[model samples]
Target: MEGLQLIATGGALPGRVVTNEDLSQLVDTSDEWITTRTGIRQRHFCAEGETAATLAVSAARQALERSGLQPEQIGCCVCATLSGAYATPSTACLVQKELGLAQDIPVLDVNAACSGFIYGAAVARGLLATRPQDDRRYALVIGCEQLSRLMDMTDRNTCVLFGDGAGAVLFEAVEGAEFAVDLGARGDMAIETPPCGPIRMDGRAVFRFAVDALPRTLHAVLDATHHTLDEVDWVVCHQANSRIIDHCVKKLEADSAKFYKNMDRHGNTSAASIPVALNELAETGRLQPGMRLACIGFGGGLTWGGMLITVKGSAV
Candidate 1:
């Protein structure tokens, strides 16, 4: 059996758009200062009544519809997020409830920071494999965050680097597909969240860790799949910073165009970044059938993960 099949992708962002100029009014930062460092021009903020669970459900609905599968057909639900509406009921459980997915299926949320979607997908695959053999076992994997609520808006450092969003991908277990994954953690606290306190991050430390982690995970996944960088159609890394991605592109001597960047538009949505970018690519018809993609993510927990997949389904 192929590792996992990507059936479709979906994403959601808050209605409120926060531009660099808008953030400048809140903090002692300028448009130039923010863009030069993070390459983020704008981001979204959840208005009242919009939570991480809401975004996750919305994204899941779209992906579920695109897959053309009834709610009862979904066998698993995995959500990746650092921010959830309620600590008790996980975001993935909420997706299952909102989407009316099967109650007997495994549904849970995982926190791997930005590397969540990769880890969640891996977890979903393993869980689905244990179920009764079926023609096509479908799983809904989502990454969502309402980091705006978790940040000290007055603190320009961490505040300016995040956005609120969610992304979801429908995965189906199919024969003859190709999927490989590599996951690791350094057990560092370069980024952390205190109990009932705003998020805290050592910018320099996390930045250093990310640059190193991205390439390591990328190579690990490629190696596990016995593939080369030259064969990759696109490299979707965590949308943390422009310099971090640019550095890797040059270091590996990979095609600059192959590295996709939407941080300029959405900033870092943590766990949601990679899948959100995937949804954008799919919606725009840029990600099509018969393509190979390498997705990498690095963030808090000092965690990192990479996955290589051969596209077998089209979004449109």
Candidate 2:
């Protein structure tokens, strides 16, 4: 087991709130169809000048402010996304520049689709471990996405299931805190985002993978940490679908109350899902200091992972 300061979390959604009724105009799907299938009632879409990097900065700024730490104190930045507006300046770099963070720290983007934020956190942990000189070792892990730009309205199957948003988790190292993580990737392409094309996904195939991944990952990290399902206060899975979480709850025979979800409003914001839900918990006063949580994510690259974290922070 390891430790995390878990300083704070913050989230940002686009200005354009597109409802299922609105999407019906652009595609052949209806609110009933999307709700019954994905449990998504609405989603946010970026307007002019609202790129992934901008959203990342917004979320990270909120987190930094809440943590009561100046930007220059941040030790590193890791942004996870599949929809960065540009390939040259990674979203993490843009966040560092816009936030006035230190220029010499590690700043890079990670791509593991829906499972990206967890990966980014692991990367940040490794990077922070290498720098023993820094006193406050804060690392900002951001999961930002702009999937609306890649939505193919013609293909209602995939188009109606994504949105644009960013979630930033800011944390530092704290001793005597319990932590465990497990990450894995299986070779598969049920979902993909091509270079010049829109999003493509095999919905049924992904559902199968997700349902299986959730419990296995929850058990993986929980077991590694010598904890049980009862010991976990929350299980925040990737907000991909309602049915997937429902099925996994039944499979694990765990309390449904422990699972937190927000996909209904945000849709599946790719890598932003879990951290976004965490931000919601914080904003709503649900996440508190010392609460035990198991966070899981699964998606393209067919990557999947989960980690156990004990919340640490002074503010709600």
Candidate 3:
């Protein structure tokens, strides 16, 4: 299999910022109560006229600009989301139109919930492999979510845990770089959104699954790639909860500092969380060429996945 090289990354959050204090007005919760539990101080919520596709277009444009690749050079586009604007056109198609990408390329959306981004990456790698090598094929993978639309304002448990945003990355196929991925899902609704209703979850069950699944998935990917935790330059897990991340880090005996986090400000943007965190790291110059990164995601569909990738260039 041809390895995948991450060329550039970009992210976009909604303009409206909802702090814990703002949420407290809707729910009977205080800042200390929310922060101590979720490690989130504020989250972005979409206002009128802003949708997942719009946010994705914004992020994707930034990624394309940073990649120095024209929109026509993209051979495939994959979007990961659970809350998109339309159930028919697919958010990927909407993004393709918004970005003015070539019509010949494959464009589709994947719904693995929070694991959507990692799943989309795996799909892009497969799609890119099938393209002619001489064509200089590139894939655009995006994770976008309008999760606030699913929030129940009165239900603090689920309402305060989500936000709206999008994140994107450009990938090119290469040889010799190591790329290994693992994905799994249990056919149960431990966390889910009902038809025409807000999000619901068995918090205890979901928390237990995340802490156990995260480290196991990380180790599985590392074993497949023949690498160790110490060898990884950064570990970017889905920004769900700080406690979940802390537990997984402790279980693996990994350096907590190597784990990048931004949920304190962005909250949980569902599928967009990982890429959003990744873009932040890249923008701040924390990411560099040739570094090894382990990315993981877990959530709704009760899905979990991890990918081991080597940084391709200084662009991201």
Candidate 4:
């Protein structure tokens, strides 16, 4: 009743699955090398007619169905993405039109790279925190990205490290369902950021940043929520690399069983990673009502964030 609660979640991926063998034909990397380094075997790419908004609409519609909410009932739409399919039209507005949302409904885009989902979640949290508890309503937050289009097919380093996908969650204010989100950006690390033109990465440097940043972010979020490591049931982080995930868990001394990962199928979808991972946890029945879930992500922009959340139910 006082803070934002997750009501439902939905995710969408491309119909086409690009395997490492397929990538081997396009680049010099092999399936074994890709899997050893990134734990990604395959990932989805958007089909002919599936743009960002189309995938977003598909996800939002499923979230609405799970939440039992009509199109007009939503207060706003928040889309977190980097590849929005256009330079001018906001992807949020496109999803709004596709959903037939009300004219006055606000829709905005957040471009925080992989941290976008938690950033969007924090935005919805702030909105809920400001509104009257009795009248506070729902906001659809979706993290969707089409990284396949941005990949440099010839660059063996980055080509096999990304895929396209989308994931969505419905948030509303309710008692006992709350989150403690901690976010930060390192502007000074701008020199280390990826290029603006295409996907470029210093895998070793990124590995170092993730190893250092994630543990601290996790502690900050845990402290903000007054939660102990033992209290957390699941850790749903951006599926960037299995090695980074392992390193972060070791740094936090978190239970290995509670850390969820499925990057073997979906590479770094950038902003879509965490939500897609969350949706996977939901599908597997690992993320359940009354469970405490922590989400953490780091990506380009040299940005990162974490959210310590308490789930209310499947149908909040």
For candidate 2, write residues 145-262 as lDDT tens digits.
9998887878999878899999999977666678777899998979988965599999899999999888999999988889999999989999999999999999888899989988
Where model 4 places Cα greater than 4 Å from the true spot, the runs are 129-136, 188-196
Instruction: Give all candidate RMSDs, comma-separated.
Output: 1.1, 1.1, 1.0, 2.2
Estimated TM-score per prediction? 0.98, 0.98, 0.98, 0.93
Please list the residue runs of candidate 2 whose C-alpha ends up more than 4 Å from where it truly belongs after superposition: none
Candidate 3: residue 223 Cα off by (Å) = 0.5
RMSD of 3: 1.0
Of the two candidates 1 and 3, the one with more favorable lDDT, higher being better, is 3
TM-score of 3: 0.98
Clashing pairs for model 3 are none
| Overall lDDT per candidate, in order of appearance | 0.90, 0.89, 0.90, 0.81
For candidate 4, write residues 4-81 as lDDT tens digits: 667788888989999999999987889999999888999888879887678888887787888788887777788998
Instruction: Report the lDDT tens digits of candidate 3 across residue range 28-76.
Output: 9989999999899999999999999999999999999999888889989
- For lDDT, candidate 2 versus 3, the one ahead is 3
Candidate 1, which ten residues in sequence have the lowest lDDT sum? 188-197
Global local distance difference test of model 2 = 0.89
Candidate 4: Cα lDDT at 256: 86
lDDT of 3 at 55: 95
